[model samples]
Target: MIIEQSHFLFVSLYIFAISIGGLLLNRRNIIILLISIELMLLAINLQFVIFSVFLDDIIGQINALLILTVAAAESAIGLALLVVYYRIKGTISINKINLLHG
Candidate 1:
């Protein structure tokens, strides 16, 4: 059994669709939103890997590594902000974040 570029692209498309759906379907949950964002990043990283493999290039993999690093930092900061917000508000609902407004 051999895998092809089309198969990789198809899987990437499915992941992208699911990530978008996750982002759109749940408007109130901050955790779900963060997970969706991570999914989207993973889907993009999948594309970068696929293209790099097909093109016989190393740059795509390097860029994907950079993206992963940035995603990690983003997730850490986002979770920290979530923790602070929850400490103050006792909830992680997006609808309730307006309380941060002065």
Candidate 2:
């Protein structure tokens, strides 16, 4: 079974689209929003890897690693903030988000 770049592209596009859809349609759940954002990052990473392999270049893979690192940091910070907000309000619902004010 030989896999082509187009197949990887379609997979990446599908993941990206689904993540975007989840981000837009999900309003009340902060966790879902975070997950969607992570998925988007993953999708981008997949594209980066695919292109790197297809082109036989290393830059794309490096960029993907950088993006992955940033995504991890973002997830950590976001989860931390969410924890604080939940502690203060006793709810994780995104009814009102004013972390600084709270």
Q: Give me the candidate number with maximum TM-score.
A: 1
> What lDDT does candidate 2 reach at residue 62?
100
- Model 2 poorest 10 in a row by lDDT: 93-102
Candidate 2 off by > 4 Å: 98-102
TM-score of each: 0.94, 0.92
Q: How does model 1 score by TM-score?
A: 0.94
lDDT of 2 at 30: 93
Candidate 1 worst ten-residue window by lDDT: 92-101
